[model samples]
Target: MIYRSFLRPILFRLSPEAAHELALDSLSFFLGAAPIRKAVAARHRGWPLGPIKRFGLEFANPIGLAAGFDKNGTAAESLAALGFGFIEVGTVTSEPQSGNEKPRLFRLASDHALINRLGFNNRGAAQLAENVRRRPPDCVLGVNIGKSHRVAIADAIPDYLTSFTAVYDVADYIAINISSPNTPNLRELQRREPLAELLRALQERNDELAKDKSLRQKKPLLVKIAPDLSEADLEAIIEVALNANVAGIIATNTTVSRDNLHASPAEVQACGEGGLSGAPLRSRSNEVISLIHRLTEGGLPIVGVGGVFTAVNAWDKICAGASLVQLYTGFIYEGPNVAKKINQGVADILRREGFKSLDDAIGCSAK
Candidate 1:
């Protein structure tokens, strides 16, 4: 309540990117201390049900901070203390590079949305892996990896393979991001030929690493796709994922299309080009989730993203077949309590609806 009514307006006053940096820095500063993290977590324990087992790992809660928020693995402890079930950090690359120029992130206040062409800017996988290794957080951490902007499309496999190995030990699971519109040709990897080679290579290495770790388990590999995919495109990707034995899919990432927006042409045009996310993305992303759920027939796990702003919105995705839900734009609009609220509300809805567990809510609408 206070976030949209009070804090959001003030933060929205600044440039989108700058405001994000300020908020992240402030949180990081506080969480860097032990006492503060414990104090914060103690107060926001949320609905402490038993551990949630998904994606071959246990999540303390179903709500997680999406990729692109903690792009450097910097403040997992702080974010976890805020009551997120898990925190996914980074769209890191094999090599570091400054992303697209300034004014790349824009706000569509009228639509309660944002358009960002931040280009997956981060400190590269090696640096991020080191950061995670040095001070591992207590909660589940998934690392999202992408190709370096400089890497050629043909060489993307090796490029992504480099990152897969780098963060293999640190991340609970690896999310292969093939849908960020900011990077040129990144989505091409979502195609069948490229996706097959990519998933196969990574899984081979995943097997090798599993042997290396013999003591520990092999981390699951998940692919994140765009919401704008055609049915044929989706089928091809699904076939590849199943054949390659990939763990799951994150459906979907931001969209370049600006259709069905509440913002006027002039106002939306003013925001220019970038991926559109938040309320405007809710239905389309949910549709993608449903399609994938049907395509896989509840066999493949999906981590839903895009436009989940409230408990109802999150519940919509769960009912449409998302095993777990994540949010980035919603966190920006609703503030830190978004995850806590969604988890608690889902628990309430589950009980009221006569569902025995969170799993019962999965695909209720679609089924």
Candidate 2:
């Protein structure tokens, strides 16, 4: 009620990227202040329903702040206080590199969407690993890794491996991102042969790291895939993921397609070429999730995302078969309380439907 009525208007006044920075800055400031963080966390006590254990880690709630929202792990501890079950930080690379040019992020208010060609800009893996180690979040922390902008398709394995090892000590789970549209030839890593090799290498290292730390449990490795894949592509990817014994898959990152939009042609054109997210991405993203769910026969754990903005929207993804849910653009449009609202609203639906637990609700609609 407060966000749409008050906050959105003020945020909408600035450039999308600037507004995003401002929001993060505000959160960081509040989060940095102990009293503020405590007050916010106290006000938004996560569903006392209890922890959700998946991917070998227990989450306080199913709502997570998706990667791209916190690329540096700088605010993980503070953001954790706001009520996320987990925070996936970074699409961090081996070496630091400036992302695409400015004006890369655009807002399509009419569509409640965003188009960003951010290109994995961040402070690099080593820095993030240090940040994660120094101040880990209260909730689960998933580190999202990606290929460096300058790394070639052939050498992408080593590039990602460096990042994986650096953050392995600090991450509860790791998300391998090969789906961002902004990175050149990065999606090629999603091909069966390349993806298989990449996951094989990373998972192998994950095992070694577990032993090195004298820890019984190694961090779960998940793949973040693009939504534009064909059905055949999804099937092949599923086979490879299962063979690699990965923990889960983040069903989508963003889409390059611009078909069927409520925004004017001029407005859409102005946003230019980038991955489209938020309400406009709902149908296609859900279609991808359904395809994966059916092909895998609910075997694979999925974190459904893209275009989720309402409790009904979140519930739809949960019923469609997402073991968990995440949000990026929705957080932008809906404001800070978005996670709590979705969690509360979904809990209400689960009770009304007589679903005892979230796991029972998975694929209920698709079934």
Candidate 3:
């Protein structure tokens, strides 16, 4: 309430990207001291409600900070203190890149949405690994890897492999991000043959690395797909994922579609070509989640990640098929208490709906 009524209004006055940077910097500074960090954790870390075991790792809760928010792994520890079950950092590449020119992130305030073409701007994968090694997040940490903008389509596999290897040691799981519209030709990698080859190569290396490290468990590999894909495309991608033995799918990244938004055409067009996320993305993301759940018979774990704002929205996704949920724009709009509020609300909804546990509620709607 304080954040929405007071802080958000002040922060909203700044440009979206600027506000984001300032917020991250402030949080990082405050969390820099170990005492302050622990104190924040104690205050914000909500009680363990219903824990979830997915992809061989146990999540303290189901709400997570999505990849784009902590692209470089810079503030995972700080973010973890705010009650997220997991924090996925990076759409990191093998090499460092500056990403697109300024004014790339836009806010659709009236619609509760954000459109970003920030392009995988981050310090390289190696740098992120070093950051995580120095101070890991208290909860599960997922590293999202993407193809370097400079890397050609044909060499994408090796490019991604380089990034995967760099973060493998620190990441609890690795998310292959081939869906962001900002990167030229990145979505092309989501096609049938390309997607299969990519997952196959990564899983094979995943096995080798785990064996070499003498670890009994290999890091879970997940693919984040765009919401723009067609139904047939989703099916093919699911087949590829199953064939490659991938751990799970993060259904629906930001959408290229601008449909059903209250923002006018001119205002939206002024934002230029970037993925639209937040409330406008909710229905489509849930549709995709339901489709994946129905098609897979709830066998594959789905980390739902588009347009989730409140617990109702998160619960809708959970009932539709997502085993877990992640937030990006919602965290931006709803303030730091988003996860705690959502987790508490979800627990209430589960009981109200007569569900015994979070696992039992998964895909109930789809069924």
Highest-scoring model, lDDT: 3
| lDDT (10s digit) by residue, model 2, range 148-235 | 9888889999999999998888888899999999999888888999999999999899889899889988788899999999888888
Ten contiguous residues with the weakest lDDT in model 3: 43-52
Look at candidate 3 and tell me the lDDT of residue 338.
93
Q: What lDDT score is found at residue 240 in candidate 1? A: 94
TM-score on alpha carbons, each prediction: 0.97, 0.98, 0.98
Error (Å) of candidate 2 at residue 23 is 1.1
Clashing pairs in 3: none
Candidate 3, 1-367: lDDT as tens digits = 9999999999999999899999999889989888988888787756356567998999999999999998889899999999999999999999999999998999999899999999989999999999989989999999999999998999999999999999999999999999999999999999999998999899989999999999889899999999998999999999999999889999889999989989899999999999999999999999999999998999999999898999999999999999999999999999999998898899889988998899999999866
Give the best candidate by TM-score.
3
Off by over 4 Å in 2: none
lDDT of 1 by residue, 35-89 (tens): 9888888776665567888967888888888999988887776888888888888
Q: Regarding TM-score, does 1 or 3 come out ahead?
A: 3
Q: How close is candidate 2 to the true structure, as a TM-score?
A: 0.98
Q: How does model 2 fare in lDDT?
A: 0.89
Q: Is candidate 1 or candidate 3 better by lDDT?
A: 3
